[model samples]
Structure formats: C-alpha cells, structure tokens
Target: MAEHGRRRWRLVLTASPLQGHMSPMLHLATFLHSKGFSITMAHSDLNRPDPLNHPGLTFLPLRDNLSATADFAGAGQFLQTLNDNCRPHFQHHLVQIIDSQKEASASEKESIVVIHDNLMFFAGSVAADLGLPSIILRTSSASFFPAINIIPQLLEQGRFPVQGPNNQILDNEEIVSELHPIRYKDLPFLCTPIEQTLKTINMIITKKPPSAFLWNTFEFLEPTGLTHIRDHYQVPVFSVGPLHKIIPTHSTSFHKEDTSCISWLDKQAPRSVVYVSLGSLANVDEKISTEMAWGLANSNQPFLWVVRPGLVKGFEWFEFLPEDLVNQMKMRGLIVKWAPQKEVLAHSAVGGFWSHCGWNSTLESMFEGVPMLCQPFELDQKVNCRYLSDVWKIGVEIVAERGEIEDAIRKVLVGKEGEEMKQRAIEIQEKVKVAISHGGSSHNSLEAFVDYILSL
Candidate 1:
C-alpha cells in the first residue's frame, strides 16, 4: 500500500550503553525527529533502568543488550568491559533488527540509515551487510580523531611509547607518569592501559571506513584536526555541532531532580553561582570526591552541584562535612542528583563550571560561555582541559590536586584572577552564541550535513 520508491528511510540511532555516549546522540535524534525524520533509537535493555520515552522517537529495546555483562566492576572496569562487549553484541543485534525491520516494512523499498556512535565498531559491518548508509558520530573533538583512529596502528608500528624503558603496556605506572606534550595521563583513560586500549582501537581500525566519520565539532574550533582527518583518510568527514541549536528554543525538562534548583538560581545574583558537575558517566574514587566536597565547602561560595546517584563512592564520606558547612551550602547551594545541564548553563546566575572536562561538558560549557575549573579525569579529558587553558584561555587548571582545589574555586569565583577568567569566559560565550546563530559555521555545517543525510 505504500508509495513506490518514495518511502522515508527511517534513521536508527544506535549508541553504546553509556550516558556520555547516549546524551549527544539523543540530542541529534531529537533534532532529526523535530525535522520529521522518523527515528528509532536502539538502546541496551541491558543498561537503562528506565528506558527513555520520546514522542516522535521510537525506543527499540534489544534482547541480549550489550551492557549486561556478568563481569561488572567499578567505573573503570565497567567502561573497559563496555568497550569490549558492546561491539560484538551490538553488531549482532543490529543485523537482527535490520532484517526484522526490513521484513516488516517490506512493502516499502526504503532501507535504513544508521547514525551510530564512533565507538560502536560493529555498525560498520552491519551497515555494509544491509547496504545501508552508516555515519559514525564522533562525539568527541575532531582534534582527537587522528589519534583515536590511529592508536591501534601506532601501537602496531611502535610510534607511541617512543622513549619508555619498558614495554609501555607492561609498565602501568610509567605509562601514567611519562610521555610529554600529551602524557599517558592526558590520553583518554583507556589509552593508559595500552594493551586494553589497543584492543579497542583495533576494533575501530579494522572496521571503520574512510568516508564514514562524522564529528561533533565545527570548523572554527577544530579546523586543523578536521584537516588532519581528511588528509589522512581521503574521505569526507562532517563537523556539524553546537548541536545545542536543535534543542528546543526554550529548554525542556528531562531529569527528575528537584525543580527548586532552578528557583534557587533565580534568587542568586546574575553570574554568581558556580555550577559543579562531572558528567553523569564519570565517577571519582572516594578520596577525590571527599577532597572536592571539602574544597567546595571551604570555598564558601554559592554553588549548584549535580551529584548523580551512585557517582559518589561511599556514604560515610558525606559525614565528614561540618554541619555548619552543610547548613551554609544548603542556604546558598543547590545540590541535585541530576540536572538539565543545558538549561542550568544558559541560566543567568551560573558564572562558571567545575567540570571533569568530558567533551560534551566541555563543548556545552563553551557554548554557554561558562569558564571551567578543569579537574580532568580519564580519557581525552586532559586534552580537552588543555584546550580550555592553553588554546581558548577560558579556564584554568588546578596545579596541585590535593590542597589546591579550594584555592582553585576561590580563584575562579571571587578573587582578582577569577575576575579575568570570568570576563574571558563571558567573551567566549558571546563568540559561541554567534557561531551557532544564523549564518554561523556550525549552522551552515548542520544544514549541509542534514542535506547529505537526506540525500542518502
């Protein structure tokens, strides 16, 4: 009964089972859905406790979802396991779903187009098998793409670990400590464990096509990196971002955290509250979490903290805070387990952010012109933090991790040095806003990318 050769090719958004991986893809899915593209977002039944429900976007649950691994450990182990398990199961599940969808929609000749996470290596094969056009959504910086794509090859070629005395994979401590310009520490956390990292990279190198890459950065921010990818791959790579533009012109509520958090911000003076959140996916061991809490408590500044459930390690640790500090923070601070981040960042009361320097957080903060207190954790965060401090001059890093957190907060919040960073951040915010507005690079790239997708 369907119109011949005129069927809409529904987009299937396939993501790895992590919040950081999913959020930006969902942001794009939301955009495509708004533009009237039918979207079926495939998620791991193995992961979500409560699956997302969007009106236009269909959430298709897969049996044997890759996220359900029996060997789940702490955050570090879990991510590595996720990296390992995701590829095989996702690839298998994708083939099954496509075959099934094709049968059901057989009357219509239109096939599917997959917008998949770059980390999901299996999608490349599945796309080819089904003769579907697949785009690898590189949600991280374009600057990091070459390093990411070549990591496995580099290990095979002996380009990295150039000067280390030991086989870099064997010397765990040496890997974290040595390596200049970008240390193993600065590398994405997975790269710190070189053998394990090589496994992940091998998957990428073996499966990815030259023309399949799509990054979440605009030309203005990462022209050199994008150029590097193109020169090396000899394929078209798209950079369409500050995806924030496609989000509702007015924000929508996504998290169930206390709404009062916004009201508290309303009461605070404009650009006065320092917002603190390490993206939902990253977890600090108890020591750093305690240090951060004490640092914030001691700073005595108004703050809004997003403490996602289970992000903190130990319950007993919260008792270390003096009751007086807790009272003071309660009066001046708003602590929610999860937040609608884009909304909070866009709010007038938020002056700066204390971030873990995840790419999404970094881009969103930049897009909002919110300066960062860069406390980088694993992975590409170190590089993202460096860009903030060295390239953009919109943030500062804490030199001494142990005792300097309080000083870092005070410096970004109220001190004379803080004033300079504050002004620079606001200036950057204006730049970001303009770039995403009409006639901006991101805007132009977005239209072109959509056109490409539509053409397929």
Candidate 2:
C-alpha cells in the first residue's frame, strides 16, 4: 500500500531464457513498471547475463544447471528440461527470492503475482504454494489460446494419434469445427500423446488458464481470430499491441553493429527493401539457408537479411555461398547478424517482411504495416500463417512445404498478387493505429488491465 492507500502491485515475471520470450515480456514488464508496479523479473543466468533495466524493477538471475544444448533442439526438449531439472527446484528457489525481497523492506512486501512465459509450466504451482495469483504470459499468438486451453478435449477426441508422416494431421472438418483452428503441427511439440508430455501441458494450462490471455496484437489487425478467441475462451483476452509502441526502447541494444542500418535504408525507395529474419530462435539449415540466399540473389531485390552466426546450423556452411553471388547480393542488399528490429521495420525502405511468423515478429511487422511472406517453421507458426493469410489478408504464405519456397518468395516480392497484399497490410496498419489511439479499444483495455492489477 502507498501514501494514498493505493496497493503497490508486486509482480515477478519469469521467462524461459529464450530471446523472443525475454524481449516482449521485458517490454510488458517495463510498461507495467512505468505504471508503478513493483517488478522482479527473473531470467536464467545462463541465457540473459545482464539484469533487465527499469527504474524500481529488480532483476533476479537463476542458475539453470541443465545443458545449454537443450534449448537448441526445440521447445519439446526445453519443456522436458523444465519438468525434469527446473520444476522440482523452482518453487523453493522462488520462495527464497521472494523471502530475500521481503526481508529487504517491510513496505515492499505484498502478495507477489507471478507472470511467466508459456514454457514456465510450474509457475502456477509456485504461485499457489506462495498464496499469490499467477498469470501466464505468452509471446505467441493469442489465437492459439483457445486451442491450448482445450488440449484435453482435443486429446479425448482422438486427434493426437492421427498425425501424418510429416507431422501434419489430415484436416478433419468435424474436428476443426469443434476446437479452435489448430492443426496438429501448430500445437507445441510438447503437446504430444506421450504420457509425460500430455501430463505436463495439461497440468500447466489447467492451473493457470493464462490469467486473462494477453497477446501482442491489436483488434482490427486480425478481427476474425480475435473474435474466435473471444467466442471460445469466454475469458478476458487483452490485445495490447504494436507492443513496441507501448514499450518503446530509448535506443537500440547493439552487440555487433552500431546504428548504421538506418542510414542505408534512407537511400532506398519507400517499400523497396524486404526485411528478412527467421527470428532469433529458428535455426535455418544449410540447404534452406543457401536456397534462400540464392533466391534473394536471383530476385534482384534490395533486402536486409539478418544472418546471425549461430542462426544457421553450422559455421562452415556459410562458406557455401558462392563468392560471386554473395558480392552481387551485397551490391543490392545489406546483410548483418542483427539489427534493431523495431527501428528497421519502421524505416521507409522496408517494404515487406520475410518472416518465420513468430508472434513478436508478426506484431512488429503489423506495427509498421509491412506485409509478410509468411514462412512458419513449427509450433504456433502454422496457426499464425493461417491468420495472416486467410483471416487478416495482411500477407501471403510463402511456403507450405519446401517445394514452394522460391515461388512463394517471388510471389510476395515481385508478383502482382504481392502488390495487392501490400495494400492489405497498409489497411490493417491504419486499423491497428486507430485501435491504440486515445479512445481505442486496446488503449482502454490496457488501462483497464493496469487498473485491475493496481486494485489487486
């Protein structure tokens, strides 16, 4: 409680030590901190070395003794490590952190609310043990919420065992009619029929139910999917998006380059360059990497491609790019390991996005009103692709399978249909801009959400 008898909300947000999860959650944490929430953001010391910076917010680092390779493979391995190595010890460690904080100042102590990324499955139990409210924060698409919430029902309906050879299940209209439009591939790999996987996901989702599912989206950007979630979940779903706007960084965080990319973009025509990144998490294999490199070279488009060293499977394979081809693309494009994504997307030169369909990237692209060449690798990506192409009409899917890769890229870049998609992207961008304005739905929802937290 504060001077005016206002309750100071104490919140602990824990992330899964992945860049995508950490980034947006940090944005949200900072936004809440600005609104006067007492925040303690916890990260695995192994992943995020430095503490998150925000005035009045404390950062706690936990040692995750598991092998680093666990996160590289996929979310399945990550969840298994969480269940086997992290979960058993998390509650005790969390209490210790809370106790340490409580001991520091008498006035600072209150019932701590836990906000965790989806992978932090044991948090609900941790919150329960501490007699605090827990909320699940997903940096992924909100449309997936209704589907995730109904996993048990999907399982009971015999959908799990019917997966096809390539991990896609044959589409069944009857099954699709009942649940949110989630394909077998779109579900997290951890949500498998294997007894342990099923049990862990069930345990986690059932406990938290996402505590008012918050997405990095705006209403008009994907109205149908938003409506679907509202109709299905019957719970408070907050779309506080173009998240970059709510929590804009004072400046970019540069590990490799200074702010040189913006100057390069200034010379190009508006909507001329394609911004390419598969996000920090998705590892592009050598073959696909080389193919994409070749396709970009062949298209003769001015582009900005972020090719971080370890993002491709192996270092030696990067040498496979023919010297001539590399030089040619360089003349027409800019290639770097990383860039300030929000800055780059907002630039005038950025015409489109060639994305892996991660929700963070999707929202960033939406924030800029840039159309996307949707290439969803796995998990909720397929669902995101459906929403972007079918529901929102903001972009077109570049590849459903490997064979469609080059064609999809060409279509989105130079084809007449691609031009139409660009117009749709601009239209949605305007709608999103309106939604976050002073009297907009998202603006009201954000204030309402913060007010509710303050009341708690």
What TM-score fits each model?
Answer: 0.82, 0.84
Global Cα lDDT for candidate 2: 0.70
TM-score of 2: 0.84
Expressed as tens digits, the lDDT of each residue in 1-456 for candidate 2 is 221153345678887766677777777887888776777777665466255345556877655676556443545556656544555555766677677775766555555678877677666667777777776666777676665665567577876545657876554323355444545545554334456556555544545355566667777555666787767656677778766677655432323443588898999888778888887667877778877887777666788888876877876235667898789888888888788888888998887898988887888788688889887776677778878887777777774343465566667767887788878888877877888889887887788877656555
C-alpha lDDT of residue 76 in model 2: 56
Off by over 4 Å in 1: 1-7, 47-53, 65-70, 73-107, 149-184, 189-191, 204-207, 249-255, 320-332, 399-403
Candidate 2: residue 23 lDDT (0-100):
72
Q: Give the number of colliding residue pairs in candidate 1.
A: 4
lDDT of 1 by residue, 313-376 (tens): 6552245456775786686677787777877888989888988888888888877777889977
The lDDT values for all models are 0.68, 0.70
Q: Number of the top candidate by TM-score?
A: 2
Clashes of 2: 0
Q: Which lDDT value does model 2 have at 425?
A: 81
The residue pairs found clashing in candidate 1 are: 188-379, 188-380, 189-379, 369-429
